[model samples]
Target: MSNVTGSFQLMKSLNRSLVLNKIRSAGAVSRAAIAKETKLTPPTVTNIVNELIESNLVRESEMGTSKGGRKPVLLTINDQEFFIIGLDVGARKIRGVLTDLNAKELVADHAALYQDISADQLTERMTQMIEDLIQSAGVERTQVVGVGVGMHGIVDHEQGVARFAPTYHLKEIPIKEQLETAVKLPVFVENDAKAMALGELWFGAGRGCDNLIAVNIGVGIGAGIIFNNRLYHGHNAVAGELGHTIIDINGSPCSCGSFGCLQTVAGGDSIAERAARELASGRESLLREKIAGKDEINGEIVYECALAGDQLCIDILQETGRYLGVGMTNVINLMNPAKLIIGGGVSKAGDFILGPLQDVVSQRALTDEVKQTNISTAELQEHATVIGAVTIVLADLFTPDLLNAK
Candidate 1:
């Protein structure tokens, strides 16, 4: 096909995919509802729905009882028509999940890496794990639509590349292409925080809502923004670098070559390091004892201690939460998102962190802005990124042309 003709065809396919995706994510709905939700024309939604039904990707359900008119036929996704795989790769662990068309988690598995394996080895292990999962789920390979990967780093999603991921030692790596080639399936790669955002948008806290932000606090801090009812990647797919934002210019050095970034203070590594220091200084706390024999402690240990009412641990978490509140105040002022969801390891500090974090933000942020935005703990926790990977695959399936080669 000629270039222009191919482009037009791609757009048409993408439009159809987008419409179908909306319906699937939004659940049972009529063509009118779909059109209204997606801002597509009624005729266009009708046409897309017809095509999807014919393709066995969507089906019509019982008609809705009308208030004052004819019943509207409800459209539903064909859950058995397709399957998606989501992978979340972290420095300390790797998690994978199988989700159906509706983004429901069907099965999940996790494994820890000994901190020495190379990227190539990680890929091999992931591939093997996926195969095992597919067999265990008893799903046909042909029914598998694609795989989505949530890796920690700066990712160019449009190009399917990880530009700079210190945790994974990845640099300009074509993670999408490599995985797609090996698995013989289309693959989408995204930063872990952004994946969590998608996860919230489709299945978790931000479901059916627009204009939300999900902050992931792990070994590093990152954010995923959903704006105008879409995942916003900003100019270079690095828009939500909340972790790198300088909170103190002359304070501690950050891994991002900056000073006093949120991650440098509140990230898992930083929290653990501070806890270690406190223990070394003979400060009494449960965490101090927990890390006595271990070379290192993680955020999980800190949270556990805080939960047990250890004064030192509670104080550390509250301090971290206060810093996080400062950063979140900036985010709230800039984006004015309707919801701010917090996830990752450090969030396990639970109400200890959330209560203080919310109090500070409420006090510092603009009153009107704070009133409109709801800051809450993430329900999905660590699994948000992996589930979000599944959501991304499903989204691509519904809008294949959006990801076509240019």
Candidate 2:
């Protein structure tokens, strides 16, 4: 009897969520329209919608045009009053945003991450940012639905733990537990790149593509995989470690302790290292004028120089693109995602890198269709990862009672 009751409740919840999502997708819809679209009986739709309205998540709007006589009352999502907080945890900084239910950013804030900061210290900084963002947005804490964090490295999203944040050399950090404890709000933690994929799906480049990949090529390389409109977290949650894929057994040593991982040659850190090495080898370029020494020649500086038309910087970016193309080809052949979206600092190089990367893909991909697989830059730019942080909470909120887990 108990199991049967539980199943009944689950079905009801699923139907409610279905009706709500139909309303959301339809923008402004009549109750009859929602019932027809979701295949729910009118009575069930009415009950669920009434419950949603009471919960302040849905509302009755203006009347829709009538076919003949009476106009239908339009129903819409109560998005304006709802809020969510998003955080992007990076190697040296943590960026945050306050957004509405529609994921429109309302306020943004950030804090630095010292190289040697402890796990507890990091959570403190994140909690403080969430607090500060709520104040900045002038919203009551209760108005904010939840906090979402996009953390780098292997993340146990189910447990809301950052299993390993490579930048801080931290392991098994209890991000969700600590933040929820501090803020008294729900917290979700996800890998930075995975979050970016979700953000792109709903609000950016990967929109309209159910199966896609978003690669973040920053200080390190990472990838987020979305299949059938859902994130694919592999067994043990290391599914998107695209950076650690070994392409060059005898190539340079990677931070992952592997020889010739894709990140070793294509990541932002590698871009800078390559530039610095050229400079150290007495290759002359405009970078020498901007930097005091080779050590100061980071990836951003190299990009700046490239934009300033430094031939060496441009060539290095081109080479990096080719390497990325090679790495992407392997994955494309393996996964054959509908699209590949590139994000992060190195991607900011734009045509300097993209042209070559595309060239390599065009020349090397196994099939003609695969070669033309709609590779584009991430639409959200630098905010991609952070906004993705906001999206995890949104995903949870939107997918509460789905029959199949996303």
Candidate 3:
């Protein structure tokens, strides 16, 4: 009897989720339309819609077009009733955004982090940032459904712990619990690259794309994989650590203690270091005049010099692109995704990097069809991870159990 009861409950939950998702996708839909689209009975759709209306998740809008009778009432998601907060915690900085259910940004802010800051201090700072974001957006704390955090590390989402972050030298940090205690809100945490992928999936380039990869290249490199319209976290929830994948057996040592890792050649730090080394060796270029010293040479400076037609800077980015292409070739031959998105601060180099990167992928990929994967820079640019953080809460809100609950 218990098994039967559980099964029935599950079915009801699934039905409610289906109805809600239909209405959400349609923007404004009628019960008859939802019933028809979901292939559920009219009575079931009516019950779920009423429940959603009571929960303030869905509301009756203007009348729909007539279908040979009285105009049907249209239902729409109550987007303004609640909000979400998304945080992207990087090695050098932390960014936050307040957004609606549709992932539209209402307010955004950021703060820099020194290399020596402890995890506890970082958590406290993040708590204050969340409060400031809510206040800046002019929304009451009660209006926020939850907070989501995206960090660069192996995050145990179920445990709400950051297991490892090599860049920050952090390990086993209880980020979720600490932040929740400080802010008094439900918190969800995930890997930054994975969050960027989710952001693309729902609101950016990956919208309607089931098979895609969002590769983030900044101080370090990582990828977020989407297979069959879902984020693939693997068995240990760390599937997309593409940066650690060794591309050259004789390459420079990586922070991960691995040799020939992709990040050693293609990451922002790697590019900046290579450019600085070249400048120190007296390789004449326009960068010398653009910056006061070699210490000032960074990825952004290199990109700017390259954009201004500096041959050495252009060469450096071209070589970095080749390395990135080598890594991307391996990814393509393995996953065969339909779309590949390049993200992170370094990707801002635009054609100075992508042209060479795409050329390498096209030449090295195993098959012509595999090389056909559409490659483009991230549409959201700096905002991807933060917006994706909000999706964590949105995903929970749309879950079957939550959607069906009274």
- The candidate that achieves the highest TM-score relative to the unseen native structure: 2
Q: Comparing candidate 1 with candidate 2, which one achieves the higher lDDT?
A: 2
Model 3 lDDT tens row, 115-184: 8888898899899999999899998776787899999978887778999988789889899999888887
- How do the residues 244-312 of candidate 1 rate in per-residue lDDT, one tens digit apiece? 998888879887777888888888898888888888898888876777888787778888887788998
lDDT of 2 by residue, 129-223 (tens): 99999898898886887888999998888889998888788899999999888887878888899999989988899877889999998988899
Off by over 4 Å in 1: 1-12, 29-50, 60-74, 399-406
lDDT of each: 0.80, 0.86, 0.85
In angstroms, the error of model 1 at 249 is 1.6
Clashes of each: 1, 0, 0
Q: Mind sharing the TM-score for model 2?
A: 0.94
Cα miss at 387, model 3 (Å)? 1.1
RMSD of each: 4.4, 4.0, 4.9
Best-to-worst ranking by lDDT: 2, 3, 1
Question: How accurate locally is residue 77 in candidate 3, as Cα lDDT from 0 to 100?
Answer: 91
Where's the lowest-lDDT run of ten residues in candidate 1? 1-10
Order the numbered candidates by TM-score, best leading.
2, 3, 1
Error of 1 at 307 (Å): 1.9
